[model samples]
Target: MKVIAINGSPRKDWNTATMLRHALQGSADRGAFTELIHLYELDYRGCSSCFACKTLGSPSYGRCAQQDDLAPVLRRIEEAGALILGSPIYFGQVTGEMRSFLERLLFPYLRYSREKRSLFPRKMDTAWIYTMNCPEAAIKDAGYDRVFAENERLLKMIFGGSCFTLTSHETLQFADYGKVDADMFDPAGRKARHEQVFPRDCERAYELGARLAQNISRGLPS
Candidate 1:
């Protein structure tokens, strides 16, 4: 079975991408064919709200109508057994790229009828990773939890799939703290914490990957 991990970070090798790679490695170790996609590399827009996907007799019914870089990616997702998406928090929300990607990814499944069903595959297992500058203890205060939680809800309610989440908190923002005026954060302290905790976070991501693969293979909740 194939598993696809999409990185929503513009920096391909930064924290978000690194965590996704670890998760993919875990899936790979469990014998699932894995591929990684960097969303920023593609030229695409969010759903155009064309309504063609919802129109009767439309050839592209229940699918995104925009023919762009994301169309093929959507096809890949439709065929995959599992999916993992990672993005860094931008101003308490997902980056514009990630938000656009999600709009296209999930909007096609929405319908106006009473049936409340979507076109998404019935059995795909999914996970979301959010990296943030806010400390873990301060997430609620920052109110970023609502954004990611709503995203998780979309995966579960629309897709009827098991959803997992990971957050890397207080992420380092620069190679040298002195170069930027990050006065609110203790750069040295944040760096030290990241050094101590990131490895463990990666381990958790690996576990998530392995567990997702196993559960998806068995057609069970992860």
Candidate 2:
């Protein structure tokens, strides 16, 4: 069995990547082949808005017809038992690349006919992890709850799978507080929160991964 973690952060070694790695490591510990795909390392674009996948009797049904770096990754996801998508919130939503990836990944599976169902029939479990500088109390300030809920709904609808979500709030923003302008953020507060909560978040991510693998192995919802 395979489980893939897609990291949509520009900084491969940043908090977002670290959290994803922890999750992947957990999947690995559970005996699933785990791989990490970093979007910043790839050259790709969002969906092209082509109707090829939607064309009647199209061979590309349920698959992205676009020729890009993400195509193969999509195939891998289609074959995998579990998926973990991690991103640092950018301007109140997932980063542009992550959003673009989602557009390509999900749009093709949408069917318009009566009894519409995703063309991809495989059962896969998914987890979405989001990291942000804002505290949990401010999560609604950006209105991400709606977005997260919608995406979770779509993942289940399209893949006939279960989905889980993790959010790491008040993430560490700056590595060196002394060199940067500290007026805009409370470095001390961030430090305290990070020291107290980030590790626990990582543990949760690890548990999520292991549980997803276990559930997928048993052909059950995660």
Candidate 3:
């Protein structure tokens, strides 16, 4: 099985990327080939809304036509047994890069017909990992749960596979809070959580990846 992880954060060694790396490591330990792609390194635009993907009889039908760095990544996803997306919550939503990536990745396979909702070629496991600076209690109040649910729903609809999510809250955002002008956060608390809780979250991410790989190996739906 092949598991691919996409990091949507600009900071490669930060919370979001760390969670994805742990997940990929778990997948690898389960005898699955794993790859991680960082979106910030790529130059690409979101879906152009040209409708070439939706146009009947067109050569690009059911596929994104944009020729860019993300296009090849989309093609590779077609052959992956599982996909894991990691992003830091920014302004109550995923990072802009992640949003754009989703636009290109999911739009093409979306069927407009009433009978069929997706044109994806096969079923595969999909997951989302979100790292946020906010506390866990604030998620529902901030309506972030709704965002997570909607994304999960869309992935399940388009991929025809099981979808799950992992969220790491109260992530440490800076090495030294005193260096930045962010007085709203409690540096001591953040550091405490980083030392006490982040490892638990990383362990959960690893378990998630292992479960996906084990399911794929056993011919079970993820």
Candidate 4:
């Protein structure tokens, strides 16, 4: 089984990256081949809304027509058994990198794999990772939940599979120079969230990967 993680945070090795690293680590421990693609290192653009992909008899499935960094990433996503996307909340929404990458991902699914195949590919699963300064108890109070929920809704409509969200509170405070405290920080801030939220939100990603590996091995589940 192959698990692909797209870390969309510009701060590639920070809060969001750290969490996804653990999540992907879990996938690795489960015997799944895993990779983390940091968006900051890639060169790509958001969907340009070109209809060229929808032209009749297109040969490219799961590929964006735009010749940029996204094409290679899309190929990896299609080949992977599981997907875990991580983003840092910026101004109550995902970062520009994440948003743009999301557009690239959605455009294909929205267009029905460029008329070549279905978006979900029969048994693939996706998970979303969010790390922000907002505390868990105050997620709704911060009003970011609405924005994220809307994004999730759109994702579900487009992908049609189990999607999970993992959010971290006081993420900014978690680090000094990109290194979180070893211990003895304010427990009230994000302790409950950290302890309670192990990999529950990302378990589906692994399960989905395993299920997908099984399905692909069984020839697309009939």
In terms of lDDT, the best-performing candidate is 3
Model 1 poorest 10 in a row by lDDT: 116-125
| Candidate 1: residue pairs that collide | none
Give stretches of model 4 more than 4 Å off. 112-120, 173-222
Q: How close is candidate 2 to the true structure, as a TM-score?
A: 0.95
User: Which residue pairs in model 4 clash with each other?
Assistant: none
TM-score of every prediction relative to native: 0.96, 0.95, 0.98, 0.75
Residue-by-residue lDDT tens digits, candidate 3, 134-197? 7899989999999999999999999999999999999999999999999999999999999999
After the best TM-score superposition of candidate 4, give how far the Cα of residue 137 lies from its true spot, in angstroms: 2.1
* Model 4 Cα lDDT, one tens digit per residue, 57-153: 6764445688887788887787776677888888888889889998888766665535534454654556777877666788888898888788777
Q: Name the runs in model 3 displaced over 4 angstroms.
A: none
Q: So what's the TM-score on candidate 1?
A: 0.96
Candidate 2 vs candidate 3, lDDT winner: 3
Q: Which candidate is the best by TM-score?
A: 3
Q: Which rank order by lDDT, best down to worst? A: 3, 2, 1, 4
Where is model 2 more than 4 Å wrong at Cα? none
Worst 10 residues of 3 by lDDT: 213-222
Q: What is the number of residue pairs that collide in model 4?
A: 0
